[model samples]
Target: MDTYAVHAEGLRKRYGGKDALAGFDLAVRRGTVQGLLGPNGAGKTTAVRILATLLRLDGGRATVAGLDVAKEPRAVRRRIGLAGQYAAVDQVLTGRQNLEMFGRLFHLDGRRARQRAAELLARFDLVDAADQGVEGYSGGMRRRLDLAASMILAPDVLFLDEPTTGLDPRGRGEVWDSVRALVADGTTVLLTTQYLDEADKLASQITVIDRGRAIADDTPDGLKSAVGGDRIEVVVGEAADIPRAWQVVAGVCREAPETDHGERRVHGLVHDRVAALTEAARRLRDEGVAVEDIGLRRPSLDDVFLRLTGHRTAEEKAGAAV
Candidate 1:
């Protein structure tokens, strides 16, 4: 059996006059969630399109389910399902009708289609709303219906391109549960998302893509550790106290703390989390600096992205182009 469900090497694709994917490579193990994270125009969607056989690569090679995407597109399509950024279900159709329709499109007989639809409804926790028209469904419900439609063939691999985009926290959580269930049942997943917290929560391994190429790949904790260990964050009570707090944090962490003067926040990486927090608190108290809060926190994926890419994710970047 192939150890990797998806693999690519030196994959390239060009659009208009520029390269969308320039020497990109990926290896996703079977039965695992591999996160593909990048900003808008970072070639994330292009990579997914290539792997799903929706678009051809300009150069290099890719395989899905051990079949060469370029040469065996049909065979690859048989083993993989793709869900894009939006819910693709028909609003006029009931949830069951939408799934059954997809099943028929995949060539399942009426009985088998109904059977698969029922199975999916129960599996995705959508049975209660299965009879309701998709137009009446919540954002989470619609997305769940979309996922169920993708599973009609019981594919071995699933490609989700920002599956939870535009969802509220509760809706996003609902989709997260569905993804976890799919993985538990042995589906290999390639998840592309701009939400750092979603990747941190759902992906076993994450690949950071930028400028149409992968720059980092590791488990969530591994990536975090690569940037730094825990850190002390101090929120001073007054903006005037920020400079003093920064010095105290710097003294404890033995490194200059980054300060946000507007927010009255000073934070620095630390090797000894507890000791640094203690010393910083003590020194700040001794120096008559009133602190609103002080605590130790692990480096977030956002920090890792900033360290590696030197900017915030595209959604947070002001004046970021689509």
Candidate 2:
């Protein structure tokens, strides 16, 4: 068995003068969920499409299940499944009928196709909705069916692009559970999503791509450590306290400031959280400044993105028009 289900080195693709994917490199270990995170138009879709054999790479090399995407596109497709942003099911077809259609398309015989359809319907908990037309299914149901459709042939690798977009919290959790189940069965998954929490929750390794290049890549915890250790956030009583609080904190630490509503806050990276907090409190009291609240917490993936990319995902989206 191959140690890596997916591997690419210097994979490049161009659209006119712009490079959609510029010398990208990735290695997805077998049975691991690798999160591909980036802002919109960051070439995530292009990369997934190329790896799934839907598009040709302009340069470099890529292989799925050790089969070259360029020379053995059919073999690659046979071993990998793609669930795109929108569920691609035919609205007029019943859920069972949809899976049966794909199973047969994969060349399963009539008996085997029916069996596969039944297994998938039950696996996705769509047996109740099996005979109903997909047009009447909820967004979450359709998404589940779409995933089940891709697994009809039991592909070794599954590519999920924004698997839970537009889903409510419950629907998102359902999709997350399904992805976890697939990994439990030894499936290699590549998940792309705009939701940072989704990636942080699911991915064993995360690659953050920007524009057309990879800006950062690491495990969730490792990425968080890159920004700093624990964060000590101080909310002051008044905006005027910002300068004084910053002056005291800046002498011992370096961090950014964030203000919202009527609160002025500062976040500091700490080597010793307890000591840092104690000193911050003592300094504030000595200066007769009222401290509204203080907190010490772990650095989130959002902080990692800000430190590495110099912009949050939202900021990147807003700057897209430039």
Best by TM-score: 1
136-222: candidate 2 lDDT, tens digit per residue: 998889999999999998899999999998887888887898889999999999999878888999999999887778888899999
RMSD of each: 2.2, 3.2
Best by lDDT: 1
Q: In model 1, which regions exceed 4 Å deviation?
A: 315-322
Candidate 1 structure quality by residue, lDDT tens digits, 159-202: 99999988889999999999999999999999999888899999
User: Local error of candidate 2 at 7, Å?
Assistant: 0.4
RMSD of 2: 3.2
Clashes per model (N, Cα, C within 3 A)? 0, 0
Which pairs clash (backbone N, Cα, C closer than 3 Å) in model 1?
none
Q: TM per model?
A: 0.94, 0.89
